[model samples]
Target: MVHPNTTPAQLSSILRKCAAASVLGSGKQAHRHALVSGLIPHSTLETDLLLMYARCGRLLIARQVFDRMPHRPLHSWNILLSSYAQSSLFHHSLALLHPLLASGLRPDHFTLPSLLKASAGLDHGRTGAALHALAVEMALNVHLIVSGCIVDMYLKCGWLVDARKMFEEMPEKDGVVWNAMVTGFTKAGLLAEAFNLFQKSQFEAGDADWMALPSVLSACSQSGDLRKGKEVHGRAIRCLVLESDAVLSNSLIDMYSKCGFLDASLHLFSRMRVRNLVTWSILISGYGMHGRGKEALRLYEEMRREGLEPNSVLFTSVLSSCSHSGLIDEGRAAFVSINRVYGLEPSVEHYACMVDLLGRHGRFVEALEFIGRMEMEPAGSIWGALLGACAVHQNVEVGEIAARKLFELEPGNPSNCVALCSIYERAGNWDGVAEMRRKMRDLVAVKTPGCSWIEVNGERLCFYQGDVSSPSSKLMLQALRGLLG
Candidate 1:
């Protein structure tokens, strides 16, 4: 309750502290008490009230108060911008910044982080750099959070050299800064660099730093580097970071599964005391990747039984498993169940999976009909799947149609051209095959070679398009050929 003569300043302070602590109920009570006692006028109290609502994930309430305010401070606009960014409404957050600036509110360091984060998601590196220049002009760009945001923005936008330069130029690097670099490299598929950085990060640690482990584990998941992942897990255990953390356990499952250790993935999943949706999805995806569709479906049912609805990703994994294992009925049943039971509207990815499943089963006509009936345009993958099935079944006419669709969808991708050529080859159309090759040449499309790697005696050995570059290449090739035989 507010005192009869309480001032607006005192009430604003209380509201701000309540918001920072995320005590929404207390904040709401205080707001009501302030109104009843007229201790805090609506104009002065609106900013803090909006902040409180935003902190509690009530954006609509925050907007209502912000819209009703007679005059709002620049910080109030910052709070609203931050609220949108935090909620992952990035485009909406960016749309508000221009109007706020045009109205004469100079964005400070606090405002730039959210804006940079939104730009990162959109891959707008040039625009982000322009904003960085604005931050410098305001003398607010040197702040740690803003620098971190710039690093993250460059990394997400695939400007790795710029990201590294930003990292190197920083006067002081914190755990958050290092973690962002690791995560950025991992997402860009720079596995060797991520691991090298993880090794270097050990000497750069502090007693209180705990954010880097999750980023390191994320690198492990992407790179399939089991040894490094285990070493990091050991350190996490020592730090008590994974004693009961479901998120870390899910990461462990993903890393282990990628490394082809399904047993270890299952073990980690079993040990998790509190499993969230991601945990279930990781396990489902792991099982699908390993071709254990029955087990994947079993876990899917168990997740629903435990009151967890399968998201689109979970359905993707289940559908992929069914497609790979020739479980056509099971795939169809799961697809139907997605809409009927979980209430998740099927996406283009789900449609692609369905086409793959049907096409692989030699239901070419049905697959074509499904593509035609899609609520949205068919993506390259859907057409490519039908084309591949036609190639396997030696159906020239259907393959030709699918090829035309694939070519139109992904003209720049040489894989589609190769698919069309393969279809021509299967149909004994020598001239058509030559024409497809000529088209590839005219388009300057080069097929990217497939590469694989394996570790031998603690050294990674990589092979590219049958290239022999390793010191032990001959022995490795012999062993592989023996296994093949």
Candidate 2:
């Protein structure tokens, strides 16, 4: 019943249609028939076969089919590039674009977006800018695809100024474009800008029922702006967006805690109809941050009792709580149980917490040995903990060793060098102290400035270590002088 007139192009079109329709079973069966009938040797059929394989997540088979293709089309190249990008192989994705260009396939608007996205994921901002220039050179600037990709790339790279400029220059805007701008501002700690955009998207009435509210709320959490955070929460409640979604709920919990409203956070957590691991982790991290270690541990027990398993992040939070509370044995037991019981690998944060816990309890030697015995490389934080302990115990020799190790690990960090200098001064070794300071000036040149902030009427005001630009500064000084007289 075979039709002799049917060509390989027709058969490949049918297979691609089936794949697009999500009828994978039938497509696979057709593929087997095509191969057995010697029809799949056609280049057109090979493209369809590679796309089918990639769609099914059989990347190895996809790559094999792609390599065997006698002729490749731009569409086939784009499919493989997107596959690698989506699979988080950014370098592979970017590198594949080269061969596509070499094959005389001029990248259209569709091709550059995925490439720009991959470059962003890889933090290759220079490559991203070069792609933008190419897009302009190719006269693809008006393409929504190119514009949106640039927005996302700039956002991911934390270049908010460039993102805003691109956003402003666009003749037309879309929801995705606005979302990218809001997300970028939020991630870059520009709470005011994110909030303004969120408000503007609501037709300028301050309703802010837009999708950007969640991201703005995240920025408020970062800035610890409680007043603004409450406003966003109220808007979420009115919009009916936070009740059912676990991620939003977890974010709210984190936001409330960061704003110093733990009671509200606990209430919100308890009232959550569904809770995920992130929910428990957020509350635990909140408690740890606020020095409520006992509450955090209690919640950990409750989490386990409720049939939720602890992951590495949860264990790290609990270990941090133990460090804050000087619970050496509890921290040690939890560290061991993370791998032994929960099958979670301990990260560097857990190791640092353990060292801090032991060192805080005056067990300096044990902390040093613990760092030495770690299965992973001991990071600077661990050495810093031991050095701080030596400072507390006035152990000059141990302090010197810990400081040296920390300096080696983080050679450009001035804090470690300064700590060693202080330890020498305490030990009356003026020569050693002078040498440490001189080394700090030479090798670790940067100084971390003091930071201050004030919250006034839901707005934040920041002051640097030596700033005196406040309007009330002169008045405060005069009032203090009058009180002294």
Candidate 3:
């Protein structure tokens, strides 16, 4: 009894409702209605059908509809490609790209973003480079969306040089583009570059632009540039920049702590009008990091009194405080009572913290027993903590066992080998120490060179091993020797 004059527009409306409601099971009925109503599906209508099926997770039906389409529009092809990408069908997405090219469909911005997303998800920068080349060939590289995708794809593949090249080549930059480069540089530990970009954003977008502030603040925190962080904080306050933004406040608190000014961090935490879980977590972790375990615990009690739930991260902070302060009884109580009291399971980090606490207090046997009782396999940190205790207390039997496990767990970690050597030396086993060095030489796992960072006048400076040929280094050496005397 269906009408014979069903329009594609009518079918599209029905399909939209189905897709939005995630009731694509009814899509089959809609398709049947289109068929029996004598409606000839147009390109737009078929694309709607494909999207409806894909959105409902009925990918097989979607492919069938795609295959049955007599004329696939460019947008329709992009939709199908996105469908596959969204479903994590990465290989299918990559394979489908060639056919899109063969069909004389030049990829637009939409097409490349989806394809580039798939490439990033797969960590295949070569394919991404090829896609970038295709965009350049089409003169679409300068398009903001395409350019952003290329920068993101390169960064995701750990190709910083290429990422920076793409970032610098952008003709017109937006807040998002600036954020990507700043965040990328921060994550890569290129604090100088991140700060420079942050400074540029200040002039270009002004202090009112809070887009890159969080990334710049993070770089400042990690680089220990408290002076620079305070300047940025002053700018944000002057701009009245999103004062309601809790994340920015949290980043400010974190930067203060990382700069060795716990009092300033504490003051900021106390002054915050709106504190989220991150705010509390950062505050407690900050106090704990400064080795003020009692203060961290007091804050934890205060946080709980405020009716905030304690998560696994909060518990980790509490446990780390106990470890650092050698609060055996409190650490033990927290470790055993985590699940019972807080309804939070102790993660690997919690277990590792307990091991560190027990091991540091000359409880190697107890630490190993705890590791044995863990539901999951003990990770490298757990074994490393136990090994460290053995090195300290010279427990040859336990040290050998822990070192052997560490060797298997982290074969490429030179520190593990060095720690094992130290344990053997502590036990006066010269042959064992010699053999350990020989094995390390064979593996070419040389100890990582030591390095340190210092922040001065909002700039970060680095000093590395064998890097003291500069004139300032002689002055630094003299100062160090004076301090030693």
Candidate 4:
């Protein structure tokens, strides 16, 4: 019960503390005290209660409190909107804008960011653009935080050209803005553009922001640009940036591993002063990538010995390593350990890895049985793995079953149709191949052509299937044919 002499100021203070600490039970009690103390209609108290509930993730109760407020302030609306956006309730967050504007309250710099974030979360570029226009009209677009959100929303919605325009037009670019564009380019698979921006950032700022380094390393890893990767690593060292950043170090380990320098990855892993589960997972996955399942398993055990619990991600790597090496027994043991030893339920990825392992070894019967016993509905990856294995083993019967399920689950994926056609061709079933091609044409399921990238003379070149646009294409194709012959 609230003390007889307790002031509204004290109650507000108590509610603020509850919100900060996420003490929902205490916050509820305080709400009760305020109601009993005849503070039910207190504006400050009600807003605090709303904020408390929102911060505690009790959005329904927060909305209830907000509805009861006779005079809702713009600050209260922002709190609720931000809460919804942060919780990824994008629709609910956007819904608040209509009521907020209808109530004659205009959105401020604080309001647009949350709404823009919600737009980004929903991939609603049009909604985000409208918010940008609103910000411009309100003269709030020039605000640093609001401008950053605008750029981020555009980038996340895949409007890279627009994002670049906004980024270039910004009168002042902070580290956050620079990192957003670089990271956006990296995620969009424009690695060269990402690296070029990274270089420009370094030149303009006189030092690379530690935040953008990971994205650059990721680009290097994706493109297999070991030369650029080494340049980045050396720059990190020279800037003394890698000394204190575990994330940056982990990215380096991943880069070296992807570049086929397993020893260098291990050496970096060993010298690290701190190692998280992700660090261990990266190294184990690197070993797995090199088809060293035994080494990966050994590291798994070592990580366990050091008292680090393995999560689903680590188990996926372990299972993948076993699949690649065809270590069925080891894969079984590791799959069983996920639930029995570690008390972690197997994810769809672990199930997919198991299917791949069994199907690759021509154990179709056991693989079918395994799928039958799955606790959850098998996802496309699981069936795709089985389908891929069918193509490898040239098993037309099992391939048909897997492909049918894939067609239903992923109608847009042409790879499954293509795989079945390949299986039919290998089995000398011309009729089946013709039927598959007809189905592909009917569904309009066009397969994306295979592409490969190589780095030479500090430049990355890409070659797609049947691509002859390059000057050296004819000679390269002749050389490739000779090698095949």
Q: Per-model C-alpha lDDT, please? A: 0.83, 0.82, 0.85, 0.92
Q: 29-108, model 1: which lDDT tens digit per residue?
A: 87887778755446668888998989988898888888777777888888988889888888878898778888787888
Query: Which of 3 and 4 is the better model by lDDT?
Result: 4
lDDT of 1 at 469: 75
**All candidates' TM-scores?**
0.80, 0.88, 0.90, 0.92
Error of 4 at 460 (Å): 2.7
- Residue 82 in model 4: lDDT: 94
lDDT-based ranking = 4, 3, 1, 2
User: Which 10 consecutive positions of candidate 1 have the poorest summed lDDT?
Assistant: 205-214
Off by over 4 Å in 2: 1-10, 17-29, 41-44, 204-211, 389-395, 425-429, 457-459, 464-485
* Clashes per model (N, Cα, C within 3 A): 0, 0, 0, 0
Report the C-alpha lDDT of model 2 over 378-431, residue by residue, as the tens digit: 888888888887787778888888988887799888887778888889889999
- Candidate 3 segments whose C-alpha is farther than 4 A from its true place: 1-6, 17-29, 38-40, 53-64, 84-89, 206-209, 342-344, 392-394, 456-461, 464-468, 472-474
